[model samples]
Target chain A: MDILLALVVAVLLVVGGLFALLAAIGIVRLPDVYTRMHAASKAGTVGSSLMLVAAGLHSGEFATFARAFAGVVFFILTAPVAAHLVAKAAHQAGYRLSRGAVCDDMRDKAKN
Target chain B: MPSAEEKRQRTGLVLPTGFAGLWLLLFCLWLIFNSSLALPILATGVVAATALAWIFTTRSTVWHYVRLTPRTLYHFLAYTGVFFVELVKANVNMLRYVYSPRIDIRPGIVKIRMRLRSPIGRLALANSIALTPGSLVMDVEDDALYVHWLDVRTTDIDEASEMIAGPFEKHLGRVFG
Candidate 1:
């Protein structure tokens, strides 16, 4: 049981860390604020939640699990809202899309 | 039938009907956080949970959204399953786009109409879209939501709405309705 539990924890931590690394690379490589926000929000939230779950499982205590669960819930609730607000602000502040970007329907609507 | 707005307006010292459930949930959380069942710990949990619940039930209009009927519960679970699957798919899609040497993406903003009537439901839909890969909700005007798509595949509003928001809408409608 101990060996299996440790293995699970190790796998989760490694996977979570890889996602976090990917998100970071994405932030550096993505073209614009919108795309970066996508990486940060999706990968960042999932990565952190996975890490929290790993921590909870590793601790093997109910209190730790509860706290970790609460953290996960809080992250899930807030990450998207934060991303939305940031994206809205970027758009409102008139951030330009990348050169290869195809269209801007919102800007077109605003003009009319 | 009392309108939600009217209920909000006519509130007094009387606790909201959801207070009991709220208190119980808070107490459970308290127990989990403390991981203790001693008399003092349990007593503290009850007191704290009660105080918090009293304040929450009195000041917030969120009680209406706290409905947990068995059907809604089932819908909620199903939505969660769908969300996780989409999350993984989104990440994989993004990984491919980000890692590819060509870096080809046809990003655009498209207007999609939302069918949800409840504010919470609409908010959930918007957030879900934002979280999903390849889509970010830029703004919501009236019944239409403006989403910034990483790859704009279709311009037709109906088709786009069905493609982008359709999967989550049915379950959210059931859960939030």
Candidate 2:
């Protein structure tokens, strides 16, 4: 049981760390702010949530696990909302998409 | 379509059910935060949850129409399963883009129709999309959501609606709408 628990913790931590790393790389590599928001919001949220869960599981106490789970829930609920507000503000501020962007329906409709 | 508050009034649960649901949720949240069964904490949890629940459910119209039931609970559990699966898929999708030798993505802001009439449902749908694979919602106008697709598969509004919002709409419809 101890070996199994340790293995699970190790895997979660490693994977979570890798996701955070990926989010960082994406922020550096992705073309524009919008695409980069994708990296920051989705991967960053999951990576942190995983670490929270791993910490919760590692504690082996129901109360500790529950607290950590609440933290994860808090992140999941708030991160997307924050990201949406930032995206909306950026779009409204006239931050344009990159050259690779295929369509801009929001802008097109506003013009029409 | 009637608003959620109107529906709640029509369904005849504007007071007791809504207040009780809010109280229960707030209390659970309180317990989770405190994470203790000690007497003082329990007493404070009860007092705080009730006070907050009353203020929100009665003193303000912001969440006066909220409803919770076993069916909603079941749907919530189901939604959690769906959410985690999509979350993993989202991570994998990012991996494909992040590690590639050449970046190949056709990002776009495409409009998708909103089927869920309730405001809470629409909010949930938008959040789900923002977190899931391939799409990030940029703005929400009446009955339509403008989403920035990391990969633009198609430009047709109906197809995009079917693809992007369809998975979440079914579950959220039952819970919020």
Candidate 3:
């Protein structure tokens, strides 16, 4: 049972670490600010949450679970708010989506 | 000018009382979980948790509604379960690509509209998008969400919307709306 628990922890940690790395690469390599934000927000939120869960599993205690649960809740609540704020700021600064993009709602608003 | 009763309702919860209540709750929780709390320490813990919960929960007028219902409880559980599964899957996939030497990645931004109307729903949607792998939400305006993607696996906006909007917005609509 302990071995099984350890295996689970190892898997979670490895997976969480990998996602964090993906998020970083996406942030660095993505062509534009908008794209980079996408990478960071999606990858980062999931990565951190997984890491928290892994920590909780490894600890295998109620207190650890509660703390990890709190972290997960906080991550869920804050990540999107931060992303929305960033995107809103970027859009206000006149960051245009790539051309040949089929629909342009923000552009249309500018026309009106 | 204000009536005494109105004032009583408004300022009824003084700081000390509030903190004491919070501390009490925490002490109780500690006792329940830890299975041992001496009287003096329990008193101290009670005072602390109550104070903290009061200060923490009362931080913003943004949280206007406090009512809970069966539907809301259901929504909460559903949201947690879905988010947990997605979080695990995204983490595993992200690790694989990141560790790979070739680093096969295609990145871009996609703008899409959200169906959620309430501030809470919009917030939840944005957060969920950010939480998922391969996507990040950069902005939300009215009904729209501007997202950045680590990979443009498909250009179909509908598909992307389905991936995002289905689980989260449905629950948000139930909770906030």
Cα lDDT computed for each candidate against the true fold: 0.86, 0.86, 0.67
**Candidate 2 wrongly placed segments (more than 4 Å):** B1-17, B59-65
Q: Candidate 3 — which residues are off by over 4 angstroms?
A: A96-104, B1-61, B86-117, B133-135, B143-163
- Candidates 2 and 3, the one with greater DockQ: 2
Model 3 lDDT tens row, B1-177:
135346668989434223433445466666655445578777766666766667754674323332256988799789878877876666666666555677666655566767766665566666776766666676566666766666666556688777666667777777766
Q: Comparing 2 and 3 by lDDT, which wins?
A: 2
True contacts kept of 2: 0.79
Candidate 2's residue-wise lDDT over A1-112, tens digit each?
A: 9999989998999999999998999999999989999999999998998898899999999999999999988888898888888888999999999998999999998899
Identify the candidate with maximal TM-score.
2
Q: What is the DockQ of each candidate?
A: 0.70, 0.85, 0.31
lDDT of 3 by residue, A44-92 (tens): 7767888999998888887777778677777777876776677668877
- Docking category of candidate 3: acceptable
Report how large a share of the reference interface contacts model 1 reproduces. Answer: 0.68
Candidate 2 lDDT by residue in tens digits, B1-177: 146568687887554336777788888988888888899999998899888887776655545434577887788779878888998999999989987988799998999998887666777888899899978888888898999999999999999999998888777887877
Instruction: Point out the worst 10-residue segment of candidate 1 chain A by lDDT.
Output: A96-105
- lDDT digits (tens) for residues B1-177 of candidate 1: 255446767774355656887898899878877888899999999899989999887787565565667998899899988888888888888888878887788888889999987777888888788778689898989999999898889989999999899889999999875
Candidate 3 chain A, run of 10 with poorest lDDT: A98-107
Give the DockQ ranking, best first: 2, 1, 3
